[model samples]
Target: MLVDQYNPFEGKMLQILDQEGNITDEKLLPEIPDEELVRLFKIMLYTRVIDRKALMYQRQGRMLTYAPNEGQEACQIGSVYALEQRDWMAPAFRELGAWLTRGVDLKTLYLYWYGNEMGSKVSEEIRILPVSIPISSQLLHAVGLAYAAKVRGLDEVSIAYFGDGGTSEGDFHEALNLAGVYKTPTIFLCQNNQWSISVPKHFQTASETFAQKAYAYGFKGIKVDGNDIFAMYAATKEAVDRARKGEGPTLIEAYTYRLGAHTTSDDPTRYRDNTEVEAWREKDPVKRFRIYLEKRGLWDEEIEKAYVAEKEEEVEQVFADIEQNGGTAFDDVFMYQYAEMTPILKEQYAEWKAFFQERGML
Candidate 1:
């Protein structure tokens, strides 16, 4: 197993693909079909396109504060590709790639960032939680989902995605501790992007590696090359397989770098240097994946130009639809709070209705 071979305690990280798209660890490379690989590459490309457009929208005042997944495509896309439809996911925001892969509608994602509740109104069949803004709280929710599945004798698994900063939160420790005792099928995916906002990871904890923390919780842990999709896929596949067999949880620390600011509201230039960003840009996930596709004769400049154009057009069209018809229903804000509105809610709703009516805006 990858966890057994890549000892986090020993500072051994699993890396199957290199920057030039060469298979650095042939033994560990996941056996992915050519068609599936091409599909995955398309999704990864779409993810980057969406992120770039989202950032542009935010700057143009068309969207709200956004988190850019500029360079972490492999970590999100590769790991999520390991999941089945029956599985569940709890994302700590910034997982644009995973959201798309899980069949979330573009309108839903945009509507949410458009500051509408409709975005969180995910189709029940998708089996994914809404974007989690509260640091490590989703870990607990994922654990609960896994535990419930365990008790019900279901084959479903639960995966939670968070950043390294979340590891410092008590909920992280609490969730892992609970999963450890219950032997739940939970996969804790930590995208160690090396920076949590302006705070570098060095300040978060003194642990040699985030994966090692799983040992403390009585489970296995593995560190992986977050930039290499092959490595992420291989590691997540093992974790998912183990979880399906009721072998308990595993912690996967995806060692990667955030090549963008923490959020649209923050300025990365204020804290980090261009030299650092440039260095990470050289390891951009999208570029390397494209190289891999090219190496396999699956992609070329003509194909990239056409595919990127199509993706960008689709992204723009989706956002345009959201702009035209994605406003959160006026009643949704009050109605979603409960099956039946409370008396105070009714009063407030009526008050707002009356105010809007007075202004002829209702």
Candidate 2:
């Protein structure tokens, strides 16, 4: 009989703050200024407000489909805050929290949801790529950019944000392989929100844990409690530091839950039970973080009300700007694609112009 090797991959999930706003382990707490912790809490509030506004906008028919990251705010905000301004981010569609944390203007984010192509054009200096809607396609772009930085001798790392669904994509495999081979400075942040639309995580993959997938690529893969801001920040900060020191990539699987529908168009209740949603809501990132802040004397009911009102005013102003700016032009499809319009594109543009002209709408 042949002896069989018992190869079991054991990955521990890191959680600093528990469901009741208490620390699970004091030793795992990340060292950061008191003000920064407050800022993180504020960002979570901002994200939740904006996300609710998105749903309101969709209901009012002012915007198209939007993927709300209401329950996963800490996962995005904490990891993003850990990055240096010089680092690059390649985002999947539901990265509003991350973008906001990285200083992406609310107008820019709103315009993108409004279906304007110009919103995709981010400044090179901002280092945030246009949102990639094709699942894990952006991971390849992130890996390529990280490899380029290596070639150019730039000490910048790239982060790719994608959902649990993205891990099943071929692009994920290719990107991780390339990063492992070249030892590229990259971080793959997987927001394992437990659902890919109507599909539950178990249906998506048979793997025991998504983080262990990193071992096959020859790097560290950590599973962090996505609801814990401190844990998310600590994990990301450590991975970022290693990457900056040319220690290659790290895959962080943030185990979270989507407390809302997958998108504005989705009816999650048709598939998932209310009990499941309620259970996840109990593990709410914002509530737990707020509890922690309260325990530290950093927050209270009065402050919460005032801070929410202030953020609401800011959101109203963003909507006002969007209303004043108006919608995107129909010809924007052909106009933004190339620096100089190609002859073929020019002909197509003219055809559309004539079509709209004949209808007396142009």
Candidate 3:
């Protein structure tokens, strides 16, 4: 058969937790303490709450477009929680899980969705780049950052987050090739959430698996059950350790699904089937992790109720602050663009201020 003679590589799929919240294997389990595992679960819960609220706000016209990361929480939280504070992360727009894990404030996150540039101005201590809107562009920035770290002999790795469709972009290949040539300590994280906006995964690529593409660039690639938190954590931990040891890059194709609409602007029902989404929902990352935690005596009804209530109050307060403050200033647009505003920009800024003042918005 033609398929038998020309196979380049087989994707190594890893799964530690089953869909029904049972441990399939003990050997593949991540070596995390119970306390740390509980913390990870809490982060996932917080992400779900934040994502759901963002959607509610979007529907109510309180916020702009937002990409919900509801089902892929494990893929994001497990990988980000494994990284050191000094490591760098370049995230695409749908990475609230990573942002929360990295300590980005809820207010700042909410402000971003409120169409404010001020929200993008994250503190340097977090070490996460601003969200990249253009698909696959963040990979190049990640490669540059990783190469710079290598040149400076810093023990840090730069992780680039993209979707399955992003792999088809030219920048994706260019970044991977450059990282391979320079042996940059970079981790290419492809959150294969099944759909890139409205495009299906099979239509995006003919390759059997996204992970196999890494071999062409001279790096190892592994596929993990993205909904399984333990599997995601183990794969990322291994890749991070390899990068810290000066080894070349690794490509991690997280085999997961997006259980929501692509964003507030696009509806998945037009192109995707309800059955497919429902099937993936059964493998929901947060629900699966919660079950695992409960089995290990790390979770209880009281704890769940308390945590949910706490996050709800916190998110409500954040929205209240945004509503009361009239959101971000219009000048915030030009202020972050340049060190010193040009004369034309200054004139435009003044015009905006006058317009707002006339309308009692100043």
Candidate 4:
């Protein structure tokens, strides 16, 4: 039976619980302590609260354009918490939960969406790259960092998070090929949210599954229910362990749904149906996890109230900080480049500064 179950093209997909909050497979479960499970759930709740608050802030004109990971908290937080602090993280635009789990302050995240460049200036000690907006470009950075760690004899690994659309990028193919050939300790996590902007998953690729693409690169892959926090945690832990042990890379295609618009600038309703959105709402990560917690007798009305109150307070504080530092000066754009600025950049900077000064806006 075990021999029949083994297939090289079939990734080791492990899911512990179903959407109905029923445990489907207990044997594949990891030894997660109850306390840690509760902690992870709380972080997931925090992410949801932050996402909602960020959306409100954007709508109220208090923040610049924002991307809300409304239904992807479990996918981001579970994978992030499974990693060691020394391991590097490279994330695309929608990774607030991952950044928060990596110890980035909520205030800084808010600042980033508020048009402050300092928001992306994470401390070197944190080992998280700035949010990459150019799609799958960060995968190359993750591969390089993992390669460097391997050369330095360090047990560290690098994880890059991108969406299904990113899988079609040339950079994604290049990074995966190089990592496989060199055996770099990297994790290529693709959050298959079923839609890339307005395009559906059916149009993203012709392959039956994103995990199967890893076969061409000579690496193993897995597909997991991204809404299942336990599954994501378990799968990421196994992948990270293998990478740290010098077993090369793993491609994880986290199957999930983007319940909200791509960003504040997008209107998903224009391209999708309300019935489809309602269908995905039934599989919400927060609701499913809450059901699991309740079944375990770990959740209650009073506890929910307390958690909501605390999250509201924390979000209020973040908004306050963002308001205090809302404005960005024209000079701030020229600080983070190379040792010397190009002639064109200098000319443009001078023009922008003068324009802002004349308008009394700097």
- In order of appearance, the predictions have TM-scores of 0.97, 0.95, 0.93, 0.94
Against the hidden true structure, what lDDT does model 1 obtain?
0.92
Which ranges in model 4 have alpha carbons more than 4 Å from their true place?
1-13, 339-343, 354-362
User: Pairs clashing in candidate 4?
Assistant: none
Best by lDDT: 1
Least well predicted 10-residue stretch by lDDT in candidate 2:
1-10
Q: Per-residue lDDT of 107-158 in model 2, one digit per residue for the tens?
A: 8888888888878887777899988989899999999999999999998999
Model 3: colliding residue pairs: none
Instruction: Decide which is better by lDDT, 1 or 2.
Output: 1
lDDT of each: 0.92, 0.88, 0.88, 0.86
lDDT (10s digit) by residue, model 3, range 137-198: 99999999999999998999989999999999999999999999988999999999999988
- Ten consecutive residues with minimal summed lDDT in candidate 4? 1-10
Model 2 lDDT on a 0 to 1 scale: 0.88
Candidate 1 residue runs with Cα over 4 Å from true position: 342-344, 358-360
TM-score, structure 2 vs. true: 0.95
Model 3 regions more than 4 Å off: 1-8, 340-362
Q: Pick the candidate with the highest TM-score.
A: 1
